[model samples]
Target: MGLLEYFRLAVRALKSNKMRTVLTMLGISIGVAVTILVVAIGEGATKSVADQVNGLGTNLLTVHQGPRQMKLTAATRNAPTQTQSTLTLDDAQMAATMFPDTIAAVAPQVRGNIQVRLNASNAQSTVLGTTPQYMIVNNVTMRSGRFFTMLEAQGNLKVCVIGNTTAGNLTGNPNADLTGQTISVNRDDYLIIGMLTPKGTGTGGPDPDDMVMMPVTTAMQRVLGAKYISDFSISCISPTMMVMAQQQVTALLRQRHHLMPPFPQNDDFVVNNQTDLLARSQNVTKTMTMLLTAVAVISLVVGGIGIMNVMLMSVKERTREIGIRKAIGARSRDILMQFLIEASIISVLGGIEGVILGVVSAVLLASFGGWNTIINPMALVLAVAASASVGIFFGIHPAQKAAAMNPIEALRYE
Candidate 1:
C-alpha cells in the first residue's frame, strides 16, 4: 500500500532468488567498472599532455621546415624528400632581430644521431646543435656547471652539454659532475661544459634530458656536416604575445620564402605555438574517451537486458500470488511499483560494487603498468546514474506485463 511496504516486498522477492540477483548485479558491476577505468585513463592521458606542454612554458613556439600537413596523400607521400631545409640559421637570426619587442629569444637547432664515447664507455645518443639562447627559450636548467656561453656558440667552440641519461651512461652516475670532462661525439672530442637537470619523458615524446647539445655552428660545420638549420625554438615576451608572435613569424617566413597569396599553401615552413598543440591533444583524447565509454556502456545495456529477462521470469512464477493480490484490493500501479523497486535495488547495489572495483583497477593500472590514471568523482556519479537508468528502462516492460495480467486467468493457472 505504501512505498516502504513495496520496498520490503521487492527486497523479499530479490532475496528469494539470491543466486539470480547476484549474477545480475555482477553484470552491472563489471560494466560500471569498465566505464570508469576507460574514462579515467583517457582523462589522465589528456592531463599528462597538458602538463608536459606547460612544463615547456606557455610562451614557447616552434618553427619547423615545410608547411603543416593536414593529411597524407599518395602524391605527398611519394614526393621526394628534400635534402635541403628551407629554414636557415639566418632566418632565426632575422626573427630575433626583427621582433625584438615581441620575441624574447630564438634558439636554432641542428639534430642528428651519433655515437658518444667517454674513455671505455660509449653510447649512441642524439646530438643537438643549438645556440646559447636555447637555454632561455626552452627553459633548460643546469644541474652542474653552466650553459655554453654566447662567445663559445658564436666561435663554434667544441664545448657540449650532457643530459642526465648521457651523464649516467658516460660516467656511470646520473648525478656525477661531468663538467670539464671530455667525451667524443662522432669521433670529435668535445669538452663537457654543463650537465642538464633531469627532465622526464613528456607528452609521449623522447626524454629531453637524454641528448648531447652543442653550438649550432659547431654541429653544422664539424659534427652533422650540414648547412641548413633543422628547427628553431622561439619564446615570446609573454603569453599574451604568442599569437602575435606566431603571425609575425609566419608572415616573415612567407615573405622570405617568396610564398605570396594564392600560393600560400606552398609555404615551406610551419609555426606552432603551445596553445595549438594543447588543443589538438585535447581533441584527440576527448574522441578516444567517448569511443571507449560507448563500448563500456554496451555491457551495461546487456546487464539491463539480463535484469529484464529475470524480472519477466519472476512475474510468470508469481502469477498465482499476483492473481490473489488482484483478487483482494491491490491496484495495478502497486504491482508495477513493487517489481520496479526490485530491479532498482539490484542495479543500485551493483553500481556501488562497481565503483569500488573501478577505483581499485585504476590504482593497480597506475602502479603496475606505469600508467597515469585519475578517477574523477563525476565518473562515479555517472556510473551509478547510468546503472539506475538502465534498470528502469529495461524493467518497465516486465513490470507492465505483471500489472496487466488478468486476475481470473492467473488464478486458474497451474
Candidate 2:
C-alpha cells in the first residue's frame, strides 16, 4: 500500500482507542514542554548576568578583601575576629595619585545594611558611603539636584543621595524629588542632596536602586560604625589602561599593607577587572544551565519509554487484526509502517502542543513573574524534532514484533 494509505489505517487504529492515544501522548507532551521552558530560563539567567556585568563598564576594576572564613575552623578557632580590612581609603587615594597616567578615578566605599525612615515610612536598605568621585567612577547619573561636593565628603557631612527605589519606598513616588529634604538613616537625619535615576534590579546582589549613597567618612564614622572601608571602585583612564592600572594598584596595595611574598596565595586582597568578573559570573550560569538541560534530556528519555510501553500493548491488542491482514494481501513491511506511523502521529501532535505550552509559559514568567525568558525559535524546532525522533526510536521494537508474527498461529490463538 501507499504511504498515505498506511497513514489512514494508522489514524483509524489510533482513533479507535482515543483515550489510550491521548494518555500515551501525555508523557511526550510534558517532556517537550519542560525542556523548552528550562532552556529558556537558563538562557535568560545567563543573559541577565552578562547585562549586569557589562553595565558596570569594561574599564572598571574592583578591589576586594580575600577569602575569609565565616565558619569556625581549627585554624581560626582561637584567632581574633578578623573583621578588619586590609584595604583603606588612603590606599584608594594613593592608587590614583601614584598612577596619574593610567588610573583616572577612585571611589572608596564603606557599605552596610541599615534602617531608613522618612517620617512614618520605614524600610531596610543598603547604605554605601563613598567619595564624590563615585559618580564619575561608577557612571552614576542624577535625575534631580546634584551630587554632594567633595568638601561635604571630606568633612563627613550628613548629606546623602537616594536611588529611585529608595525614594519610592520612603516617599511613595519613585520619581519624587527628595533633594533638599531630610530622611532618617539609622535614626540619624541626613539631608538629601540628590536623587539618582532608576538603575533597576541587580543580579546576585542587592538591588542598586534600593540603596542610598553617602560620603564614605560619614558611613565609617557614623552610620555603619565601621573602622575599615569595604572595597574600592576604580576606573581606568581608558580601556587600554585597565591592565597597567591593575598591576600598579596591586603593587601599591601590597607595599602599603606590608604583605609578605608567598606571592598572591598569601595575599589578603584580590583585584578583579570587568573581564574577569564577567567570565566568572557567566561560568556559574553556564554550569547551572547545563545541569538543568540534563534533567530535561532525562525527561525526554522517560517519555520515549512511555511510548514504547503503549506501542507494545497496542500490538498485543490488535493481534487478530494483524493476523487477518497478513492472511489476506498485507505484507510485513506494511504492518511495520502502520505501527510506526501511529506512534509518529501521537508524538508529532504532542510536540506541537508542547511548543505552544512552553512559549506561553515563558511569556507568562517574563510578565507576571518578573523573570527574563528568551525563547529561541531554534529551540522550538529542535524540541519538536527530538520528540518525533524519540517516538520513532521507541516505536521500532514494537513495529518489528508486529511484523514478525506468524499469521496462522495469530489467527488460531484467539
Q: For each candidate, give its TM-score against the true structure.
A: 0.92, 0.92
Q: What are the per-residue Cα lDDT tens digits for candidate 1 across 59-84?
A: 99999887533224676665665435
RMSD of each: 3.4, 3.0
Report the C-alpha displacement of residue 343, candidate 1, in angstroms. Answer: 0.3
Worst 10 contiguous positions by lDDT, candidate 2: 67-76
Cα RMSD of predicted structure 1: 3.4
Candidate 2 C-alpha lDDT tens digits along 236-323? 9998999999999889988998766666765678899998988998898889889988988898889889999999999998899899
* Model 2 lDDT on a 0 to 1 scale: 0.88
Quote model 2's TM-score.
0.92
After superposing candidate 1, which stretches have Cα over 4 Å from the reference?
Answer: 67-84
Q: Whole-model Cα lDDT per candidate? A: 0.89, 0.88
Q: Judge candidate 2 at residue 157 and give its lDDT.
A: 97
